[model samples]
Target chain A: MREPRFHEVEGRSLAYWGLAALLAAIVAAGLTAAYFMEHIGHIITGMTNQIVWGVPHVVAVFLIVSASGVLNVASIASVFGKAPYKLLARLSALLAIALLIGGLSILVLDLGHPDRLIVAMTHYNFTSIFAWNIFLYLGFIAVSAAYLLVMMERRLNSYSRPVGMVAFLWRLVLTTGTGSIFGFLVSREAYDEAILAPLFVAMSFSFGLAIFIIVLMAAYRWTQRPLGGAILERLRNLLGVFAAGVLYFLLVYHVTKLYEAKHRGFEYFILGTGGIYTLLFWIGAIFLGGMVPIFLFYLARYRHSRAAIGAGALAIILGGLALIYDTIIGAQAYPLTIFPGMQVSSSFYDGVVNAYTPSLPECALGLGGVALTLLIVVSAVRLFRILPENLADIAFDLDPHEIGATPNRGALWAPADGR
Target chain B: MTRRKAKRELDAGRRRFLGMAAIASFALAPGVRLIGSAQSSSPASARANSKVRWGLLIDTNKCSETCQACVSACASYNGWKNEGRPTDPQWIRKVAIRDSETGLARTLPVLCQHCAEPACVEVCPTGASFRRADGIVLVDRHICIGCRYCMMACPFKARSFVHQNLTDQRPQAPRGIGTVEGCTMCVPRIDAGKVPACVEACAREGRGAMTFGDLNDRNSAIRRNIAAYSTTRFRADLDLDPSVQYQGL
Candidate 1:
């Protein structure tokens, strides 16, 4: 068995500069949009009293959830001791950190008084889950950074497993905290379910791995690095499993709500006649995000096809967004049941479906967050020895037992399982 | 003779000590009052007492669906109006409700419940949404980051976020863009030793459907009415202990 050599990306190419510049421009545009929304007020955006959180939040929440999930790749390598996954560990940590920063940027910038962020930082509201999540998100970034250091530095190599274990537990709690943002709300019927926490965890795994596959494939192909089919197959299969887990949770969530008389209206709104919400749930979340990816991964003929694998991963990402959109906005659109047996109407838009259309600036801001994530990842790979020099099957064809002892500070790496 | 003399001396010292303590209390009274007044303030009403729970009772039976006097009064006093948009802040609104089963209809004014335990107060990431000692829920404009979690958490749809900047905001009511605002229960008027604008207007119209009083005071008009009538709190199933109660709904 030989140790895999790691090196920094040569980012001097024209295409590299072009991509970075494009991302930078989008980030700038997003900042500009935020400035107008802040000083000019939220009226400039599509956000109103009814739909307070719009496209920016949908994008932000998606990134934050996926950020926690992206670290699973490193957790698999270091905590579970999966040798094949080890090659992707550094990039995983980098991507996780990048994605979180991107998501957090959107959330902060979208605030009504983004300037008063200092107040949020200083104030202590221990009871609020949103307050707790501030620390959780920050702690994850800190922990993932430490995990990356332990894996990269031979001087701290032995601590990787312990740190990885901490990160793994932290991410699970982080996702739970994220889900509880909605789950804890007694007012909204769509969010009050206990299953939302685990559902988010499942979603993270699927969404996280889907993006990882896309990034890994793109980075390897572009860098002229050999990403082995063996690892790809393993990751794709895992994605299928995670997607199925999400599906199972969704089913339980709906069935349990259906059993309760109080939740029947919400369930019907999302599943039956709730227009876009129902379409997103069925076609976007269930069919595209769930069934399509799962089927693509499991089918015998498409098993080895790179195009199928990539498409399946892309489908999962798109579907994950749709699911999140359905979860966040769809629930909000359903009018709140203020009166149990009464049909209420008021000047306040009460007892009626709230209308929301995403403004362009909001769309730009949302896209900016995604671009920022890619920009950070793109920039980091060039600056640090985050990517392995090779991931060919021949390089990783080693015994599982020999993999954990991987080489020193930015020097040695290995793929553990070939048996 | 010696034991009796010692007991007399101790009693004399105890009397002297009590006199000094009383003098110290008198000296510290002004200082204590200054500190108390500096810590918090009531803009609309005189000092809110912990013993007082300002509440409202609305008799839906007497409320006319055609008359929006209370809503108009609230809007005028709070410096908020329809502005021809759904996004406009409604400090108070008239909701027309119809029973789906019985085909019975009722109209009532809906505003911040000023709940004893408010969902908005519980979920505000910053302690911006708060309940005062007198059970009046208020939003601190400086602390509210406009996350709108309070709006989402509020079961009554009581709170509203300011969608746009305003040039002519009332000097009295708290105002900020990217911040949440709701019914302050006319704290300024209460401070001025007056009823809320809506209550005053309702009374002026001779409808007298709305009553604002201290629910804690057993002898108060609101408490006496509650004692005599069958009343309902909106979404009582959640057990929020709302200060506002409706009769004959």
Candidate 2:
């Protein structure tokens, strides 16, 4: 093996600076809102006895599903043995770790007492899906972080194949567990279906792939490099496949609910009620989120353009958000009972029955979570030097001998790289 | 094939038949006795027996919306202060239920069902909640670990947990923070040979919505009323064989 010269890249571009500024603004707003929620208590939020969980939960689940997408690069390299994804592994792993932390932070802040979160871990109810989710989420964060470490460490790099495999398998189980939290409620009548778990898995792939593509494109731009035409085409093809899978799962999920008619009230809330939420599901999720992205990716010339790929990625991310929001909101939209010949009105919210509006504080905490995610990603990139200057160089690194020539091998261990 | 072998085989078959006979007798004995006793008992003895187990029959139709007298009386008798919140200590709660298809609403007052086979008792790890010999489910707060598992196990949602600290809680029902509680059918009143506070309150209100009597007493007011009018238990799918019955929904 020959020694390779160190290439000192210049500071971040204007685009990076702009993104950082926006992220900081979001974080500041979110933190200020969170401080009020904490000091004033949940009374400040729109949440009441009826609608206990609102936009905060919606945003949390959105980030969680998006975080699931971080596993795609590792999954392709370890599970499917795709060589082109090898160089992007560490970067994807770091993003996955950061996203989970962001998701958890939002969830913890949403709780009645941020201090009592340890109780959620210590007080285990084996039967309650919510209790089980606490454990599963912790496991996901640990495994993703461990895999990231293994990817970045020179000594542990050889163990990447096994570590990556475990990380991939764990995410699939974790996402399924997330789905089961809703699906296993046979008594709820609203969520008594087997398809939710599998649907969640499909969603994890779609959202995961979308985030990966966007981040990879940005990383390429930051390094003043370009991804190979063939590699970009391949990624676009995979995104198309994922979009189709998500669409199929979503269609079957809703159709089955309609067929059962057990949860007709909730079903009607999503489809029959013509409102912002309905528009979000039909237009944002089904069309732009699902169909348009697939169509763009399938077209060769469109898929090759970086801007077009970014647009498709954005559409998918927005669609994933819409899908999760629909799931959480749709379930609680109707009153719990619809017994024949019973006229019961809600006592909580006056006049407009079954209402929900996320308070300003809730919105603030959600934006804060996004800011935290970007900060983690930016800081990790600065310390780890995971981005490739060019796609051709990335292809070269895929070979075992060429990896030895990469510079600053010792810098991978520095504490500043902490995600 | 041999004489000894034949003897052993005969004994084994005899034991097997005996075991089967025992199971068959066990299954048939309750139904047979129920019918047999129905024929044998005289009307007068069935009406006035003190040894018979007391139960309540509530006519939900006659229950007025303003008739929270039962809840009030139960709370007062038990010495439970009304904080007027759902999370507070509530011995009895009135759940407003509406029919999904017809959209008709009715308020059903619910307390501990005092089940023959109580799920809360079964799932209680500390044995804090237990069913008495007479079939009343009672919680020993002294032994309660405050796990709240019983609250989750209850299908009717009858149990409430004390979430706040209070020094002024009444002595009769001096519940501390982190204890699960529900209606006790006014055991203290029952010990004094009086009807439960709720039953007395209902009777005083003149609607006669509640009738308390010994269920084992075949000719008691509750048994007779149940025989004359149709009654139902909430969530009968649980098959808990609840002592409390409701009529005229």
Clashes of each: 9, 18
Fnat for each predicted structure, in order: 0.80, 0.10
Residue-wise C-alpha lDDT for candidate 2, range A1-419, written one tens digit per residue = 12222222344778777777888889888878776766555657765433445677778777776677777877787668876676667677777877888887887776544555555555454545555667677888888888877766669878888888888888887788778766754423346578998998888888877888887766655655545444554666788888899999988988888886555656776776837668888988898789889877766556345456678888998888888877766555545442223554322221133566777889889878978887888767766656655554335343322322222122221123221
Which ten-residue region of model 2 chain A has the weakest summed lDDT?
A405-414
DockQ of each: 0.56, 0.07
Give model 1's docking category: medium
| Chain B, candidate 1: TM-score | 0.82
lDDT of 1 at B48: 70
Docking class of 2: incorrect
lDDT of 1: 0.87
Give the Å shift of residue A237 in candidate 2. Answer: 1.7
Pairs with backbone N, CA or C atoms under 3 Å apart (clashes), candidate 1: A4-A413, A83-A416, B44-B187, B44-B188, B44-B191, B45-B187, B45-B190, B45-B191, B46-B191
Report the C-alpha lDDT of model 1 over A40-120, residue by residue, as the tens digit: 888888777777788999999999999999999999989999876778899999999999999999999998889988999
lDDT of each: 0.87, 0.69
Expressed as tens digits, the lDDT of each residue in B1-249 for candidate 2 is: 699999999999999999999999999999999999887773323333346566788887887776688888887777665555433456675556666776565665677888776767765545667776556677777666454546535545456665445566565555754456787777656655788889898889748788887778888989999899899876565577788889977
